[model samples]
Target: MKQSLLLITVVGLLLSSCSVSKSARGQRDLFSGTWSLDNISYENNSGNFKSVIFNDAEDICFEGSEWFFRDNNSTGRYTIAQSTLCNGGDRFFRWSVVEPSQNYSSQLQFKFIDENRKDISGGYGYRLNIVSLTEQAMTLKSNVSVDGQPVTIVYEFSKK
Candidate 1:
């Protein structure tokens, strides 16, 4: 009876350990749902924070925007509402999370696609490092170039 009890305890310990690690990997699937932009900020060429005013096309496109991620698929939809400076519509894209590894950090990538799923956002694709991710919120950092100047954008989003 004592031998059987010891074996049971060891099996129980192994099962519990497996459960814990599997839940961590399950976090990758938690990205599904509609996310709304909470706010955005930028870092200038000098790597200093730069405030932005939303008044043009770029700004309007982000206003009232909603990102919808589907479970178990790399395709998603970006929805925006009509505004004075923008024509709101739905756009499809291919998105995936880069699994972090020993040699490199993880990031989120987006490749704009048409109805047929052809690449369109840019040939190279957009990559943003994930700053934080939780059940209710996510943050991403993107470095971009505008007019020969380097800039970094920080985006905070919350589930809707």
Candidate 2:
């Protein structure tokens, strides 16, 4: 009788524990890590989409670029490493999320804060909508205007 009661209690506890769900990175703190630029794709005004090709040799300078996110901080840095394509030494610029309250997985607003390069204003910002994100990879989409035409850009990155 005691064995039966013990077995029933154990089974009950196991069944009750099964409902606890694991939180994914998208729902919680998961963006604080180094990420590398994987690739970029863009859509033209006519609703046509195409991937940007790094056909030029100098374009490879950014192929090794990185974006580092600080833990619990909405600020980050865009790091351009020194390469043969670029000899300006290593360059780092301040960047931050315009609004950290919103979900980056849904819609993320980004702004460059380095005033020397360009004027930092509320008017200039980039919007990235996360398409996919995992511990290994993440992809985001940004709608941009080029030459008065709307374009949708998809940026793919890998965690480093």
Candidate 3:
């Protein structure tokens, strides 16, 4: 009876280890894909604007693209940077997305830190916001202040 009990305990330990390993693998897969912005919405003094934003890869310079405003006919490029991922241009500017929680498998909150640019007011040096992530899609929601006023913008991206 004692030998049988020991064998059962060893098998249980191995199974538990396997389960943890599988979970880690799944989390890594979440960020390992190409993403493109699909939609965006925002409000300004004039009113509000909602439209679809497409990633024009041809215009991408250092992994960033120009955001087009369909209604007013305006455009702006938001640059992203990361230390290790940065190809060149500026050392302080690296392009990458940061996950809020360490556990990547669960709902992910992302922040696009643009160390190279300053906010509209010039008081804030960088842009920070929460992002939603899924297997094939990612959405960035910005509730950042510009010129002492609050502005919200949502950008959705999908896997290529």
Top candidate by lDDT: 1
Better of 1 and 2 by lDDT: 1
Better of 1 and 3 by lDDT: 1
Off by over 4 Å in 2: 1-28, 44-61, 82-105, 114-124
Residues 73-95, model 3: lDDT tens digits: 11123334444533323212212
Off by over 4 Å in 3: 1-28, 43-128
Q: Choose the strongest candidate by TM-score.
A: 1
TM accuracy, model 2? 0.54
Best to worst by TM-score, what's the order? 1, 2, 3
lDDT of 3 at 70: 15
Which 10 consecutive residues of model 3 have the lowest summed lDDT?
Answer: 66-75
**lDDT tens readout by residue for model 1, 1-160:** 9999999999999988655234334545767888997677776765544343222236436745898887566788877678776677877888877766685456777777888888875665667788788989988887777778878787888988
- Cα distance off (Å), candidate 3, residue 59: 13
Q: What are the per-residue Cα lDDT tens digits for candidate 2 across 136-160?
A: 7878777666667778766788989
Clashes in predicted model 2: 0
lDDT score, candidate 1? 0.72
Whole-model Cα lDDT per candidate? 0.72, 0.57, 0.42
Model 3, TM vs. native: 0.36
Give stretches of model 1 more than 4 Å off.
Answer: 1-27, 44-57, 101-104, 118-123, 146-149
Q: Could you tell me the lDDT of residue 8 within candidate 1?
A: 100
